[model samples]
Target chain A: MVQLGRRYGTGPSSLAEIALDEDLPRAYLEQLVTSLRDAGLVVSTRGAHGGYELGAPPSEIRMSDVLRALEGPIAPMICATDDPAHLLGCDRSARCTVNVLWVRVRDAISGTLDSMTLADLVPARNITLDPRDPTASPAGVA
Target chain B: MVQLGRRYGTGPSSLAEIALDEDLPRAYLEQLVTSLRDAGLVVSTRGAHGGYELGAPPSEIRMSDVLRALEGPIAPMICATDDPAHLLGCDRSARCTVNVLWVRVRDAISGTLDSMTLADLVPARNITLDPRDPTASPAGVA
Candidate 1:
């Protein structure tokens, strides 16, 4: 997502290029991109100068959304499905001792993922020490 | 763990009994008990009346420790292994854009699990309504 964000407006990036750059299998990337496209996270173009691009700006795309699109709901346990409706499938849901714990865990994970955006994962460039701060530089440096 | 905690001091409970009560396969329970015993979470006894019991009190055993013992470290991603050494397997550790996000997620999950203990999951016998809170009772209940 961060890589696509970086090259968003430049042009659509090919699956081959993304796979190569990300060091992921091209076949896996193909399957993943199909899901991403289906989820409306990315759009594909056909013909020359065509490839894939984010459906929206990186900042607008939360990590939670991407994760859900790729991995389904963030369920840590079979009985702790992300949807409350799914809990009905578990016979012990009415009195499951550990259900609450799993729910809390799932919520914590989902909350953290939701709180982050693709923009947050974009690497900062040319980070330099604060010259005005006396302790900014290492002992061996300057 | 909960079952063992509930049965603590009531004499060691056999795998067959625990499996029947928990509706889990005896074979599966046997394998799980081995791991639990090896992790020092549960102790076994020998003889006709021998079975298994929690190694420690429920309150003293955090869910995080049990999960780690049974499932290994709670890693949210391949690059976000709980052990720093395992991160070396990922070539992009030096500049993986999503590594920090995954670490935060892993921490959030671990924090939640660590905060809960076996005591918390032990089924409450009788949950009473808050006397000061009128809405605490069910709609049809007084």
Candidate 2:
């Protein structure tokens, strides 16, 4: 996603350019672009000046969507997934000990990813860093 | 990690039991157990009643360690890992576009997992599922 974003930031870039820039193999990137295109995340152009561009604005994309496109479901535990749910056959589903915690973590992760859009990740303005206080006490630091 | 945890949950559950319970394959579970035992997360005993058990108390173990033991590093971005840092070689180290965001996500995941021990997950108290209200919002319901 970052590689694509960076390449697109300088206007639409070819798969070859992106592959070289990201140090990923061009053959691998071709398949990746096809998947992204299939997901409607990227559009491809044919001919001499042809390349790839964001199918929609970067702001509209979510990291989770990108991840799911590249990888499958973002499940930490197989049991937490709904595409093929009830993966674990624990007899005591109503009171399974670790299931609840895994569910919480999976939900939290999904929620966090869903809450963030690509726009949140890439800003239009020049980025700056927040200054850190070297003299600040570590007392309250978590 | 849950699969591994189920395999080492202080029981005589066989590898087949763990795999069947977790909806994983016997061969895959076997490889995982070997890795876990090598990492000292589980110990194997011999005999008719022999099986795997937690090498350390659940409270003493962190999810980060378990995940690392099972998988590789928890780095979301290649550049944000200790194994091979600065993978992207971006000019702006302080203002890299995507690494910072991935680092935050990685930290959030690690922090949350580290805060939760297996003991916290497997409480003595039984879990109860609130009756589903059809009219209630999904966000507010589960």
Best by the TM-score measure: 1
Interface RMSD of 1: 0.7
Instruction: Give lDDT tens digits, candidate 2, residues B113-137.
Output: 6777766654433334555645533
Each model's Cα RMSD: 6.6, 11.1
Q: Model 1 Cα displacement at B124 (Å)? A: 2.2
Model 1 score (lDDT): 0.83
Interface RMSD, candidates in the order listed: 0.7, 2.4
Candidate 1 C-alpha lDDT tens digits along A5-105: 87877779997898888888989988988888999999999888789999998889999989988898789887887866655457866656888898899
DockQ of each: 0.77, 0.29
Error of 1 at A87 (Å): 4.9
Candidate 2 segments exceeding 4 Å error: A1-12, A82-97, A119-142, B1-60, B69-73, B76-78, B82-97, B123-142
The models' CA-based lDDT, in order, is 0.83, 0.67
Q: Which tens-of-lDDT digit does each residue in A1-142 have in candidate 2?
A: 6555645555567878877766678899888878888888888888887888887667788877876777767776776763465466556565466666566666667767777777776635433343564454423345
